[model samples]
Target: MNPIRRRPHIDYELDAGGRRSLWQTLPTLTPGLGVLRHYERRWLRLDGFAGIAVVAYMVPQVMAYTAIVNVPPVVGLWTALAACVVYAIIGGSRVLSVGPESTVALMAGAAIAPLAGGDPERAIVLSSALCLVVAGWCLLARLFRLGIIADLLSQPLLVGYLAGGAVLMVVGQLGRVTGTDVEGETIVAQLRSFFSVVGDTHLPTLAVAAGTLTLLLAIVILRPRWPGPLIAVAAATIAAVVLDLPAYGVAETGPVPVGLPLPHLPIISWADLQTLLLAGLGVAVVAYSDNTLIGRAFKPKTEPGEKSVPDVDPQQELVAMSGVHVAAGLFGGFPMSSSGSRTALAIASGARTQVYSLVAAVCIIAVLFFAGPLLEPLPSAALGAVVIYAASKLVSIPDIKRLARFRTSELVLAIVACLGTVLIGILAGVGIAIALSILEMVQRLARPHEGVLGRVEGIAGMHDVDDYDQATTLPGLVVYRYDAPLFFINVGDLRRRALLAVEKENEGDPDHPVRWFILNAEANVEIDISATDGLKALHDDLSERGIRFGLARVKQDLRTPLERAGLVELIGEDMMFPTLPVMEKAYLTWAAEQAVREQTALEHQAVPGADEPAGTPPARPVDTNESDR
Candidate 1:
């Protein structure tokens, strides 16, 4: 060979035994490089503005959510920053920006207040512990692919639950915004405090709040993506700076540490773990739900206009967001939720990858590292204004309108979940969702749809005693179809109706004793012990009456249970068919054999005058054609 060169890496195949997948380990991608590569793309202008816009909106929200948790505003910034950075690495969603979410923050605050004794440092400690717990839970979830739990939370429940939570969040914040010292230990206590301070509202603060509300509404009705919160926050900061709002009982965003996240792995005692268990569980559910929704929402638009296509891997989202939570805790920060407002901003800004979040993270770091003193002067009122506006977005009118069209029970459940979120707590709201879903499912189970499988006339191998219209039936053979699982709840009705129908068909018909009855098992997924017992009893009773009971189109999964119950043995192999076509063939063969046997018996017994005449025509044939007569 003419100076053979070394084979390129492309030609080198690594041993299959030692290969690791990217997901199994991890991959590094940074926005700076990505942004540089696509500098001339339209995304550069739109997404760049969106990042800054989102950051502006986020600053106040972080402060507000932190406040709700009784932690300092800087902690919010710290947590949000770390979250952004961590998510940039691990998150699959191109636009999702992890940060302090209102619902989760409120939940964290409620959980930590008693344990931390209102100390910011101590609260951070507990939050860190909580974060670890959540991260552990999420990691466990990913390992087990437990993301299906989110699917069980119906849309109606989510809408209602969030609406309820929003109400609670707004009410919870009202006391702090007003000058009144409303007395309460937690949300319920805080609700009382908010109400008590109704008359003590500061006119100026109220005016600011009013103006903010108006701006947000105008934005909702017109430019939905307008930076109303950012503008409102800027205005609040200017007012606090120039108006000396603190002296007039306006709270201020106190000192925020401007440095690294101290790595203090929380050492909570077993006692502490016990106390936080319920709260931890609640946070796990709410955080998973809230984060997944946001993550999936911001997942890159793969199919044009196919917003419903959820491309974000739920397991990935959990891992990413939980990691962010852990990172935030390491850096002396409050608990965070997936930020919807910032996400919307990112989408509006033409962000192509998760780099915008990284940019946001850097910006937060810069603000904390070098621009600290500048932010220190920022007022609590401004942050409060930001919080109010961010929370307002949780209430979606279109969602409510959509909810209105659903079943009353589901709609009521949604409303209950929302109110529960508002008046009770986040956990209760989720519980209601679970309860309602199960209940609705149970309602269907209670009275399942059962139909007589009667084929129309002029149909080949036809049969039916039609419920929808007058139709012919096979003289003595009946087919019943149940469109639900065979279970204890509905088994009694099945036994009663099937037996009665068989008996009625035999009413003194000289030539016909109900010979065969077949149950359509196409939709039945399973039959439990109780159902099996009922079926055994039905088989015995029908056999005693000289009738054969069998099945048609029993799905594969149900075969094992039926076999284990000796149903197949009792029904005989020839009587069970995998498809309707085969079943029809089997039925026709059985009918012909029975007809021959009947004629043979009649001729054999013809010695006496008791023999019936051949004048009586044979029984009507079954027609199984799908079309109606």
Candidate 2:
């Protein structure tokens, strides 16, 4: 391993007089230039080897992904070649390999299939247009700095989505694998169709596919680090040519067109554009989500002493992906994204920088110009087998099992997302995953957790009364903690929980009836008019019941709203404290003072000269300087 070399830091602050910020300019212009400038010549040999390996791995995989998109294999090759060059220049990560990934291909195919109306040329045109639309979406997101949008698909949702996509990919390829006319709009329908035609499955195609699949799996299990797909594809191509499998009723990939794709805009109708816009947006979201997830996962590891991975600008990644998609669209190709498998392979094969992507592009160009005919004998079933192998790996069984063991609700969500993709459509499945994630968040916020706080013996800080058995509550004081922000949807619930805490405390010891309610507002980051009004009403209700309302750790921003809502006046300004300890001290002093005042009134009432009626106390004057004191 090379010793971690620290780059010298230069402070280049932007000034008001038209001075550009190096932070803004450098990331936009040459994202990969930093690594390239400090390029080590010794790493070139490894990059070169990795580049060749990527080419070998990418060609077959991209060609296989084309089947998912229902396009000519050459289009997939063009997509891989074009995206690689563009991403190498602008991408944030070094080893991330951009290409026609299966998920994006599946989404693009679904989006364009209706518009194309069974025409392969039209399909290509629509797919290219979709790529352009996706590029536009990426650019929009980057401009708005919506990089955090990728996190909408949480890990559990993503795991389920990919697992569902894996199932769809495998099922969709079954027709090619078995040479059966399995037809359906969805996975369930396709499975039904497949089962009905099971008797008519072509033995030759199934044999080739099964054999190829077995060989690839065996290579993966035995050698593990070898380019198993590439090796399997080559061996399958040789076997098909030598055995004349096409004559024996096995379908082959057909002759690949020789030459690079010419740069041209795909002509798309306005109506088709309108229809595809939503689908393109979905594709962009899923693609970037998957791309960034993979990018972050394999982020360049720092040396032993480093605290974090090198900075990965998500906006720069968006820009890089946009450039790749726009280039892919211009070059007669479909949409693309970062491939996790190829990226891992590149890193494992010793790739050092984006230069490896450039080398891979050059090698792919060579294949297009000279070796296109060599791939003609590759069997369709064998390609399907390769895709199946890749897709099978997408299902993270261990992750699913882990979720099941710990989080049952999230496990159900994962299963539902998986089932949604397999039973509905891939595009709908993504929608379902995103919707579920948002719904889960809203559900948590609506009924957020509440904790009753009490002081623990020998503990320095306050603790949850429910969590600690030995936690002691102050006489006549109920301290409550709301774990979520104060919002219109949850304010009512917060009020109910607060009252319930007081009621529960009183039930525990009716003799020391709860007289003060202190809210720990540390978790309440946001407040709205509805929540503010709710707080005022709660304070009034508590005051009528002879209970004082107090707020602790209230953020500075919330004070303005509380004043505007008259809550500050209702609860008294002195009732708000900056910390729990201060609040406790003030509450204890007030409780003791109230007790003294009551005892004094009682003694005065017992005297014959008392002016107040029996069982009635004279109104006390408000102390304006109490908080100041």
Candidate 3:
């Protein structure tokens, strides 16, 4: 005999001084530092230009979103500055621009307006408190590695939610543009209030609104890549100052607080804290959902064998956003999420890393300190026009039409969500959308797909019998497959469907009774306690009908539950096979042996009871074990 050759081991070691310490490795945890470690000089100019573009785009757009949050326009600047700076350091994505977004702003307003009771000061405090609570929820999610919850809200729900929010936004700005006191909680009531005061509209404000809208539409249609909102706002501000439109009863921003915001925790009552906590959870879900969606949409693509960029970790994203909202709360801003439009703008302008976000932050700081007075004369109508434009982008006619063509039910759900938001409120509409998403998921789980397995002439493995016209099944055998986890929700249904499959097969060819039933258990990776009981009942039913129950392709994890439930003993350990082919081969061998025995018994009976008295009845053939046949 030849001796076996063993591979030699080599020791791996390094001196303590040569080894890297934890502190040195800690910096890599922040994606920003990792990108900086490989920074190129050529990217500097590109990122700088991208950052400038982001500033011009965000300044007017973010200020307009503040109208949704019902906060001072300066507070929006605070949100942009703090969120962008913090996200640049801790965020997972290189190009994602985190800041005030219209949907989240609208949701924040919905939660705060009711509690503040028309006090703007109280509303600001509530907004800041809500930011802190949202930060807490994000941090909690990161700690628990619950990033998968981002998919809890379905796409159909989001479509409807955004559509609903757009209508609410346009309605909210009607009063500003018309210079009337439009006050109502619902769209119907708001329109009624607006019409009641339509006769008393301020003509100068209406004129400013018309000019601003026309300029915005023209720029958007002709020069889409241009800073349309900024241009529109600047022109209106210049006109307001030159024409003295305020004297004609046109409302202006008046005075914005100059300089940077001081970092301080917002104070609130314990009751308010409890109220804000719930609102915070909703806001966090929406923010994270949008952030993840945009982050994935613009993720840089690479070809095979190419060195790719570091992928964004979902859990790390939660941590980064937690820091972003914490910064916002400290700076007296509101809850914020990633703006898809701003992110697209940054990417389009050649942003290569988070450094662009830092540049944008610096520019916003400059605006907050040096340009606040310049914007004081900006007309409310122009801001309203900017907001209405932003809102219009939220509704996608193509998406709605696609849903209608592919899934009419989902289209209806989306419309319901929109109507719910307009008729009810932003927060409640979101609640309804989330509920609908959950219900849709439950409906799918409660009635999963199942199929009967058979063989086709050219097919290599088992396939659904219903799918193939020429598929054939083995005599006296039934192979079945259930394409979902065996849970309490649908285990009873599984039992009924499986039994019906066997009965249908037997009835199709009564001469070949189904003596063996085998389940393809590859998809049943999980089986809960109730499902185990249900499985046992199924086995008992098969046994009563003289059919032997067996399992094929059982997962390792499923063994312990089956063993604990005593199902393994009840079904017989020998009947469980590792693969379908092996099981089928063994069944064929047994069937051959049974056929031989039956033929022998028939021969003896024809020979006038070879083993019994001549006058006695011929011995009847009996099955030693039905499973063997």
TM-score of each: 0.82, 0.92, 0.93
By lDDT, the better pick of 1 and 2 is 2
Q: Per-residue lDDT for 1-629 in model 3, tens only?
A: 98998888778665323446799746744777777778778788878998999899899988888777778899899999998888888888889989999999989988888788777677788899999999999999976878986888888888999999999999989999999999876679889999999998988998998899889899989998998889999999999999999999999987899987688899999998998888888899999988888887775333489566666777778988889899899888989999888888888888888889999999998999899999999998898989898889999999999899998998988988888888888888878888889888877877888898989998899999989999998999999999888899899999999899889988999998888899999999989999999989999898888788999999999988989989888888888999999889978987788789889888977887677876888867756465253
Q: In candidate 3, what residue range of length 10 has the lowest lDDT sum?
A: 12-21
Query: How does residue 366 of candidate 3 score in lDDT?
Result: 92
**Cα lDDT over the full model 1:** 0.71
User: Best candidate per lDDT, number?
Assistant: 3
Which digits, one per residue and each the tens of the lDDT, describe model 2 over residues 360-471? Answer: 9999999899988999999999989988988988888899999999899989999899989888888998899999999999889989988989998888988888888888
Cα lDDT, model 2, residue 552: 94
By the TM-score metric, which is better: model 1 or model 3?
3
* Preferred candidate (lDDT higher): 1 or 3: 3
Candidate order (lDDT): 3, 2, 1
TM-score, structure 1 vs. true: 0.82
* List of clashing residue pairs for candidate 3: none
Writing each residue's lDDT as its tens digit, candidate 1 over 161-259 gives 777767766766675666556666546787676777688787766665556556656766787666666666666667777887666666666666777
Q: How accurate locally, in lDDT, is each candidate?
A: 0.71, 0.86, 0.87
Q: Which ten-residue region of model 2 has the weakest summed lDDT? A: 620-629
Deviation in angstroms for 106 in model 3?
0.4
